[model samples]
Target: MELVTDQHKKKAKTILKWLITAGIGCLFLFLFFILSLWGFAKIQGPPPIKVPQTTRIYDANHYLIGKVEHENQNRTWVHMDDISKSLVNATLSIEDKRFYQHHGFDLKRLAGAVLADVKSFSKQQGASTITMQYARNLYLDHEKTWMRKLTEALYTMRLEMNYSKDQILEGYLNTIYYGHGAYGIEAAAKYYFNKNADELTLSEASLLAGIPKGPSYYSPYHNFKRAKQRQKIVLQSMVNNGYITKQAANSAFHAPIRLVHKHKPMNRTAPYFQDAVESVLQNQLHIDQKTLAAGGLKVYTTLNSNMQKKAEYWVKQVINPASDIQTAVIAMNPQNGAVEAMVGGRDYHKSSYNRAVQAMRSPGSSFKPFLYYAALRNGFTPSTTLRSEPTTFTYNKGKSKYAPSNFGGYYANGPITLAQALALSDNIYAVKAHLSIGMDQLVKTARKVGIKAPLADIPSLALGSQPVSVLEMAKGYSAFANGGARVTPHYITKIVNQKGETIYEWHPKKEQVLNKAATFVLSQLMTGVFDKKLNGYSKVTGASIAHILTHKVAGKSGSTAADSWMIGFTPRLVSAVWVGYDKGQSISTYPDSGYAKKIWAHFTESALEGQPKNSFKPPKGVVRRLVDPKNGKLAAKGCPNARYTYYLKGTAPNEYSHRCYKEKGPENGRKKHKGFFNRWFHWFH
Candidate 1:
């Protein structure tokens, strides 16, 4: 009996020793895990929370015109005060019932979730509080792994320690994705209900609050029935949490939630202009696309909505939708170079290629004015005679030859005054003038007036063989209208940051690049292109349409086999229009009275409707003289054909004709010239 009791006592002692060892090992393991968790929490501070914002663009009147959104992340941050109380209550009830009581995680919910998962034999339950979800959203990936969860927990603790409860809620609401390209509560509200967050009703709030759980599964836009089911669950949760009465929950669940039936895609106003502005900002400010997409910029442009509408209307009216032809128009304040209106194409939705600034097409005879301006600066008068007969020339040491002819092969074939040559758009005369003035001088003149296209020294450049954009042409013509002052075309007038601080403002730089007197003389000569009756010639050029309006204007018309252009200006506005196929096909089937001139005339007339009509004021150092149209010489009173011609002060005709000054008898009918010089001049007369 003694031996059996001793053995029992020994067995009991061994069992107690084994139990103590197991407890010590378990305690050591717990201590090590706690230490490691503390170290990790200390090391990992917080996660980066990116609240993607949309960049907005406004017109001159400060109306929202367009928005640039980040890929799949359209967010608009709203204050907690602006958020609906119903949405907040619903979110708290569904996501975390004991959010206010917990520090970073709910210990009771965690234990319950663990027990439930163990019972189910799978990780099927989540115990994440609002703070923990926010931490995971901002800092850690949503991976079902131990390391990710540990990091998420550490971030949650840091978030709870640093931010208040309201801040945490705001962050979670703003960072959560509600599907359909919406990344914030404000965006989601706008996307689903077409209203702001503060304006959401109880039904709408519950529906939106339930979306974040499984955006794809609960999106009202995608699956209305599923979304309604989830919304009912949220309403029940709100009722169970005592946030709302059972009666209110029942009313919400039974209420007809009017989900927006047709989701209206964001409509872009003046998309081409917006594209040009974006390109300008990117290039001039050295702004990256990423930075631009993460927007907070307030760009003020020079677009006149009224004028833009007019331009767009005229573009549609002139071009048939079935035709392959495309058109571009640009209008500007000639005095300041502000681009008031621009239409890059007929439909910006089909294509975004900005024809006004990007397309480089030949200007045709529209380029003649630049050559004439150069000639005028080189001591050539409007009355200076040039042989307009068809001609040819050899260049490049006789390796190349050019023989340009007049349109329709209709040549004057005689001495024609500079004014008549320009009015008729004589190709031979233009090439002759370009050659006489030197190609280098012509290119320099073109450059001074804002033609940025590369122009070769070839003679065809006089006829606009080189490709130039409509914007460049507008700027070049603006120099003529602005009295020879070169203008740099620009759209953005000012830019403000999100903080309401001015970050950029435009200060125009005007340079007087052409002689004022010469420009006036050149402009006066171009006016003859629009004259109803020039001595014996009838109005036949593109400027003939300008004669319909009472406003005084000067312009030129140009056409190639494939392109047509009209660039004109008044004292206030300068506009340019181009029409052609996108692939540079022949538009020769269309007449000179085609889309280009018609659109230009209609748009210019509409743009200048309410504005004052101002005439071009001639500068000093210009002289007017009466010359015989037949001979381009000083006119006598008895001369049958005579008109006033413009010339620089010292460049007018120095010789007078006495052949027509003599009185004639009725029998003789006309006076006869006896002198050799008079007879010689009589041949041309």
Candidate 2:
């Protein structure tokens, strides 16, 4: 028995010796592998550190309109000096008590976390130091796997070796995600307290420190009671870490915290406009999405806040909220083509479709001015008479016949002058003119004045049968208001980079596309829509809203089955208003038919409130003469209805009205009826 026991002991001792040798060898191999990784990390610096930031937008007056962010990551980086001490201390206490003492990994906390995770049979415990967390945030995905952990461990060592303690902490604070679309401490401060990071109080700091643990659950905006409980735990941790006294910790926990009002969280005052500006930045400017998100570029737009407010107000006041009718309003500067105000739809939250730039609807009779401009350029005068009776004409070499009637099926049934036809929005006269000038000339004329939408060379084009956007109409009308200088509609006027250098600037694109003298005569004739004396068989299209005019304005009104448009302009500003259903439903003729005119009147009056009532200045060689609109003949004292009519130099008729009597004047009173330009232009010279 003694011999057997000795043999067993010898075998056990031999096995123990071999096991010890193998264990020592494995430990040495592991150490060598770690050292090799450390050496490799030294040669490879950190990956590019690009933190997402917020791009702020401002109006023409430099007032903040809203902010733009990428993927809801709203972050604004700040220096360590800008952060409050309380926030830093509270964060450190709850997150890592030995943040400064440890290099990268804390063995004591790791051991405890491992033991707890083993006992609970789960991998829910975390022992990441600030440096380790920072590395994970910057470089690695947050997937709890063995491979990811090993990668994270390698990155942690690299961060500790390359950066100082303060650098690591600053990066951690800026890159961490908070609740409610806020990605950094500064953004959290602004979103929660409506204040800056340096202005946070002790209670506010504690409240914010508790959010990073579970942003959605501990958000005060989500659950106040849970947020308060988390704040108390943070305060207790601060006291235990010796960063704050017990008395101060208790006081902060019991103090009342005020959060920002839960209203307008997105700050989207003009969401549609913001979207249009972003599209221009991406598509037109060729700016990539990634650069736009983090480039910190400042976009200065031409939006007038006062005008925008008025546009929105009038739209709401005029259109009933319960109705499904959608409306779009666009106002621009006639001289520069700056888009002063824009409303895409009735409500932005309900729908984001921008009708001003998107919806393509017919402009109705408001498109007559473009046709008339084409006529004037082709040697057609305002006194040119056309038969207004309903008639069918054969075109396409006798292959097509088109017959159009005036509104309400009422026409003069006789020859009518162009001025009276335009004032009444006569369809037959426009069709006659469209066919007389050849269908292609109107298309060329429309394109020359900035109408970008495709127009068909057909007789129906004369009555505004082609669909176009409100913005296009506004842009086309700006030419007439600015004496035929075509302008391009644009939102952004300048863009500045983070280095305070201007990268883009806009200069007015004023191309002279129409004859100045002809345009001046056309503008004067357009105002006949409001003149009652020119009314013959039909009321002027603008007669319903003429009493609301506080300034000298010239414009046209148009409508189709599904659309109603009132587009007009002054010397300084031009606006186009449209009301219709999205599904192309026929609008009622009574109240729904009148919404566009009312909105236009109110918005135009409000937008031009503080400005002067400036009149359109006629370019040289344009002349005005008093003549009867009924017959387009030279006016005499015996004429029943006489008014001042504008015409190109030498285009005025020399023959007197038949109602005239023999007068004691020079050359049968022909010299007494000279054009206004004959006196005004020569006198100035």
Candidate 3:
């Protein structure tokens, strides 16, 4: 019986030993399998993958305007040389002290960790070397298990063999995820310092190099106390490893964990102007969403921060916030299409609908200038007389009638100059002028003035009952300032890629639609109106705001039921200010004019403060001549009632060539120009 008991014990021991051996063999086989695969892949090369490139927008002077990024990280990439050698050395010492001495894993650390893990009830063990950390970062994840550790070891072996020490160190610095959306040491430095990674001091470098073991636990955002504690551990490890001195370690330990609050990556400085730049990016660059959002791009816009601040301040402090006035302000350089500033609304956070670019409210009387411009092109001048009267018109085959009356309804019935009617924004007189000049000609003239809206041959067009964007009207007004050289309003100045290559630079191409002579004469005549009526400069007796003879500025004021607008320009800056409600309703009553002139005056005065006090220079072909506005007659000093007005060269009416052939009465059969169907119609008209 004793011999049988001994035999049973011996068999049990043998079986137990065989089972242990089998398990050890299986684990070794698995490790060998993974290592073999890793080695094979390393011989082949890293798998192909698309690397994301970043983009940024900057101002004309290369000041950072905004950036495109993803994971909330605006990464400015750097090569290994870009960072200091201390950064790499510190990271190596802190992450894996025995990295250089080991193949991939340290057998001694593994043995000690295994023993400690076995003795400990809590199954926490760490055997990661620097190479193993790189392996963990690149491929393996936080499993906290033996199998994952084994995989990490195998991968680390492959990494060591595939890349050199410097390359592996570079990968560690770049691929290691730091807190605050930072993926690398370079980004981490910026995250903590607001400066480049290469700019880090020894203390800063050590602090950042200590984060990867448990970023959240060591993250400054989480708890500065814990971060300091972990940072101290890093300093101790560096000291124990002899990488840093005790004095250095002690100083670093006591140093304050001054963590910078990571800046939000957004170029919200000018939402409107920035949005305008994005529009151009979409159309010209044909960028995709992935590239725009995740590319870590820096973009520079054409906005001068100063001008943008002025525009926004006026919109906020003086314009909209003053009286629930929804204001749209657009300013640009007349020389080029670069938009200097744009304020779409009072607050972009409340609403992003760019009113300056999108809102097409009826330009009211502002559209009349184009009609007057058309007449100038078609042989009419400021001195040209249109019989101003209460007129009625039938439309839709007489089913509807429009008794288009002047704005005040009391017209100077006999005959008035086109200049006076335009200054006062006469609705009846402008409609009559439109009929005499032909609506087709008016539409053609509008296209020339940068009024791109589709035109209908309707009488209402003459009174500017057509809706036009404030941006369009502003650029249209620039023609008068620029002496008839039509410039299309543009927002985007240039676009740059992530590589600092200029994808596009905008050079505003100006087109001369109207002859220079006509533009100059029209500008002079419009300035005359401001001199007489709309000029807001009350203190200056002879000096008008829009028509300071010393400084030429010509513009038009317009109001729809819901909106009131004033587009004015100097030779250099063209500014358009629009006031209205976002929902298109009249919030302020008429003649209760809400900040039209005040805002205009404020903006103009403020905008022109820094610019050269230069006046508009009329182009070479303009010939200014005076004629009697009441009779379209060559003026004589004795006619006290007659007003002298300027006319564009060739636009003035031919002096009634046959003076004796002038018809008998005021209602005598007559016609004004060649387009008229009946000469006798004037009597009835």
Q: Highest TM-score: which candidate?
A: 2
How well does model 3 score by local distance difference test? 0.68
- Compute the lDDT of residue 392 as modeled in candidate 3: 90
Which wins on lDDT, candidate 1 or candidate 3?
A: 1
lDDT tens per residue, model 1, 1-685: 9999999999999999999999999999999986776566556664466554466777788887766543335567798999999999999999998888888789999999889988988767889999988876665546566677777777887787667899999988987878756778998887788889899989889999999888767987667899999999999999999999999998988888776655544466777888788888877976544445554677888888889999999888878778778999999998999998899988765666899999999999999999999998876788788887768888777898899988878876778888888877888889988888888888998999988799999899999999999999999999999889998999888888767888889999999999888988888777666664353332447544755555656788899998999888887999899999899888866553388988888888888897666577778998888776655678655465456677888899978645345433322323456568768888987
**After best superposition, candidate 3 residue 624: deviation in angstroms?**
2.7
| Model 1: ten consecutive residues of lowest lDDT | 662-671
Candidate 2: 10-residue stretch with minimal lDDT: 660-669
Model 2: lDDT to the true structure: 0.85
Compared with the true structure, what per-residue lDDT tens digits does model 2 show for residues 1-685?
9999999999999999999999999999999997888877766766566554467789999998976654356468888899999999999999998989988888899999889988988777889888888877776656667688888888888887788888888988987777756778998998889888889988999999999888768989778999999999999999998989999988998888888765353557677888889879877998654446556789999999989999999999988777899999999998999998999999876676899999999999989899999999887888889989988978999999988877789989999999988898999999999999899998998899888898998899999999999999999999999898999999999999878999999998799998899988998898888888798987888899888887778888998888899988888999999999998999975778889999998899888897777677878987888887777888864455578889999788776675433433444344543688666766766
- TM-scores vs. true structure, each candidate: 0.63, 0.66, 0.58
Q: How many clashes in candidate 2?
A: 0
- Ranking of all predicted structures according to lDDT, beginning with the best and ending with the worst: 2, 1, 3
TM-score of 3: 0.58
Per-residue lDDT tens digits of candidate 3, residues 1-685? 9999999999999999999999999999999996787677578564332355546667767776665433346456578898866677678777777777777668998888889998995449887777777676555446577788767666766777777777777777876767645777778887787768787776777778777766656877767778777777777888888888989888867766566654654447777777776666655666643445445455656687777888777666555344555778888777665678888888765666788898877877667777887877776767666676777977666787778765445666666666766776667778777777777888887787777876788898887777888788777877766767787666556655556676666677887767777776676666544554322112111222444233445667767677777776776888888888777767456432545545665667677775565575656665544344445555333332334455555555666323222433222223353345555565677
Model 2, position 487, has a per-residue lDDT of 93
